[model samples]
Structure formats: structure tokens, C-alpha cells
Target: MMKIGVIGISGGWSSEQLADAVEKKTGFRLIVDFENLLLDLDTGTVWSGGVDLSSLDALMVKKIGAQYSPALLDRLDILRFLQGKGVPVFSPPDRIMGVLNRLSCTITLRNGKIPMPPTIITENVDLGLKAVETYKEAVFKPMFSSKARGMEVISPGLGAREKIENFAKKHGMMYIQKKIDFGRQDLGIVFLGGRYLTTYARCARGDSWNTTIRSGGEYKPFDPSLELIALAQKAQSLFGLDFTCVDVAQTPDGPVVFEVSAFGGFRGIHMARGMNAADLYVTYIQEQLDKGLITY
Candidate 1:
């Protein structure tokens, strides 16, 4: 039996689903929580619940943390260390790091000529206010966040400066983007091993400003055009993640990429398309291990 470990939150839906899939395939199940991880540099060992993670055949990262935070970067560094020790980690810590910070991800996408909403990133409250004024309406987002958490829509006038200032005080840097009229929906284009797998749309419910499930949104199956898939493929190729989801919005100008997810959502893919992404992902890992492609 292959001993495959999963690094994720214990009670997380996606994490548990992935562990179940791995157990079904390899007859071994271990969900390694970062909180319980003990990395001993002197011994070059990473222990979690008495299991040496470095001894696993392969490790999969379903979710690094329950929420997005800079602390998650430190967790990724631990994975990078494990990878250096020759444990095959899916998605590769380096690639995940590339898309972890919103600013870094945006810079990479812009450098690759991927179209995005008009944006500004700065620590200056004046500039943030100016951005809101310029766009009339802008969304202030944390550099490290998911599910629209800590995101605020600020329109010019009426305590706009105070809003930006308060956000900047908490986050240090503000990522403000011109709010695009995306018809209250956006697409999550999923890819596995750099190949297009499926597309799901998140439709905002009622008066929510963001199309996140936490914001009262629901996922639905969507069929994207060939051009849209090509665009998403080009965007995901920049990071070369083993599994990723590209958030894109179709605007009057065409499709513009929002961000390439570090850990794509399994629920959206499953609920919308009825596809078992965890099973497919585990199978992909097994194939890579069989091919000897994940050598240290």
C-alpha cells in the first residue's frame, strides 16, 4: 500500500474528500495538519501525529489553511523544505507561492499580457482614495484572502477616505481594482495538469457585491467558448500548477482574468459539474508516481 499524506485542515470538506480518495486508491489515509506539523531541521524530519511526512510516497495539498493569511506562506515554506527532501508534493510549493499573494499573481498575469480589471496597489491612502475616485467604484481587497473575505466595495464620496484608510491600517497595503460590471457572475475555469477540465460560474444572489459563496452565491455549470478556454490556459500556464482554477470575468471588452487560484475549490467543480475532482487528482498523482516523474 502506498502511504500518501494530505496537508490540509482536518475538518475541511475538500481536505477530507481528498483523503477519502487517497484512501480508496492506495489504502492509506493521513491528513497532516500544519498546526500539528513539527519540522526538525536538525533531524531533517517533518512529523505530524507521529508519522514522518518525508517518508510518504507522495503528499497532496488540498488546503494549506482554513483561511488565507501571510502565515500560510510560512506553511508553504515548510512544504518547500519537504520537497527539497524529495517528497513529491502536488502543485509544488514554489508554484503555489507564485499565486499566493494577490499582487505577485497580478504582476505575473500582467507580465504575461493577461487582461485584468483596472487596478492599483499601494500603501498610500491618498492613492487608494484617488483610485476610488477615478473608477467611481472600486473593490479593496487584501493581498492574501479567499472567498471574498476582507474585501470591500468603495464608491467615491461619503467616508471613502476613511474606508480606505481603515482597510490600509489593517492590511498595510491595499489592492484596489475598478469594479467591472460582470453581471453578478464570474467563471472558475479549472485545469488539471495544465489541461482544461471544466468551467463553473458563481452567480451572486440578491444584493451581494461579490460572487462568493460566503456572499450568498451559488455555482452552476458553464460552457466556455474555445477562446475563453485558450485564454484561461494561457493564464494558468504562467504558473504551471498541477491543479488550478482561473477566475475570469467576461466584460464588454472580453474575458479578463481575475486571478489564478493557488488551491482551486473542489466544491464548485463538484456541485456544478458533478465531477469528483479529488478522485481525478489522486489518480493523476498515482500516474505521476508510476511514471517516476516526481523524482527528487
Candidate 2:
């Protein structure tokens, strides 16, 4: 029995399915809440819910929804400690943070010469307004959110300044992007362990955000263009993530990346394409174990 530690048990259909698959493959799986984990200083002991995390064969980060708080920093410290103790964490805390920080992703993609949406991150409201004017329309997204939550599309509008101020006040910085014209659909490509799993286009419901696939919105399975595939693969490598979904949008020029998600959910794809993300992930874990590529 391979003892594996998963972050949290997120209650959703896809998560449930994935959990079942992982359990069936590994036999023994442990649900760990990094916040609930404690570390002893002198003895160098790490315990969570009466289970010593150091004893686990492997640590898999799944549902670690932490923010920029002291507790979250402490959790990162614990993750580093686990790595120092020779326990393999599939997506280390730094890689996870890189994907979550919107600014970091933009810089990394831009530095790598990967095309993405024209983005502007600013602490000053004036610069933000300039970016909006430059693009004539912009989308403001939180640095640490997904599913299009806490996002507002700001064009030349009456309430644009208020929106910018409110966002700056709330998030301390404004992360804005030039909205792409995808004609209502944007590609969402999933990759696990550096291998492609599936690709689907997230279609908007009426005038909704193209990246979001939720109620009334839908996703359809399709073969992305060769350029799209390469872009997604390159982003997966640049982020150094074990599993991720690369969102891309096509303009007149070519396909531009929207954002890469480190903790993307598969409920939308499960409902639309009927492809199982959990099965792929668990299979990858098992393969690593079988090949002795990953160890405790």
C-alpha cells in the first residue's frame, strides 16, 4: 500500500471521482489539511491529525486554498521542511504559488516568449486607467482566484474608476488584462505529468466571461490547433506543475494564453467531454511509483 497525502477533500463530483480512483489505485490515502498540521522544533516532528506526515510515502497537494497570511506562510515552511526530509511533494509550494500569482504567471510567460492576453498589473489607479484606455477594454481579475470570481470587465464605462479603486482597496494591487475577442469560446487544455489529457473550449452564456464554464455556459471537446497545443505544453513546462490547465484564446493574429491554473477543476469537462481527469492523475502517480521515479 502506497501511503499518499492529499491536501483536502473538496466536495464536488469530479473531486469525488478522483478520490475514488486514487484510493482504488493506492489503497491507502490520507487527507491532510496543511493548516491543521503541526511541526515540533527541537524533535523535528511533523504531525497532522495524529498522523506524522513524514511517514507518508508521498505528499500530493490537491486542495490547498491558502492566502497571503501568516498561517499560509507557515504552511509553505512545512512543505519545504517535508521536502528537506526527502518526502516528495508532487507540486511543491513554490510551483503552486507561481501558478496562483497572476502577476508571476504574466512575467514568466512573457519572459518565456509565450503569447498571452495583454496584461497590466499596477498599484496606481492612474496607470490602470491608462491600460484600460490603451486597450479600450480590460478585465480585472483577482491575483488568487479562479472560475471568473472577483472579476469585472472594465471598458470605457461610467463606473470604471470606482471599480478600479474598489479593486485596489480590496486586493492592494490591480491585475488587469486586455479582453480578447474569441467569438464566445476560449480553449481550456488540460495536462498531467507533462502529457496532454484533453482540450475543450469553454463557451460563454450570452455575454459572460469566455474563460468561465458554469451554469448555462458549456464546454465542448475539440482538437486544438497545433499552435494551441504547443503553447499549452510550453506553459505546462514553464510553470513546472505536475497537473494544470492552460486556457487560451484565439485572436486575428493567433492563439494567446489567458491563464494557467494549478488547481483547475474538472467538473466542467466531466459534464461536457466525459473525460476523467482523476483517472489520468492517479495513473500518473502510480506510474511514477512503479518506475521508482518518485519515492518517500
The number of the candidate with the highest TM-score is 1
10 residues in a row with least lDDT, candidate 2: 65-74
**Alpha carbon RMSD to native, model 1:** 0.9
Q: Could you give candidate 2's per-residue lDDT for residues 1-296 as a string of tens digits? A: 88877765556444466667778887875667665778887777789889988887777776665343224545666777887887888777778777666788778888988888788889999899889989899999887666777788888778888888888998888888998777878878888888888888777787566546543568777788777788889987898788888888888878888778877747656766897777777778777767888532
| Model 1 lDDT on a 0 to 1 scale | 0.93
Among all windows of 10 consecutive residues in model 1, the one with the lowest summed lDDT is 287-296
Q: Alpha carbon lDDT of residue 129, candidate 2?
A: 85
> Against the true structure, what is each candidate's TM-score?
0.98, 0.90
List where candidate 1 sits over 4 angstroms from the true fold: none
- What is candidate 1's CA lDDT for residue 235? 100
Going through the candidates in the order shown, the clash numbers are 0, 0
Candidate 1 per-residue C-alpha lDDT over 4-90 given as tens digits, one digit per residue, 9 for 90 to 100: 899898988999999999999989999999999999999999999999999988899889998899999999999999999989999
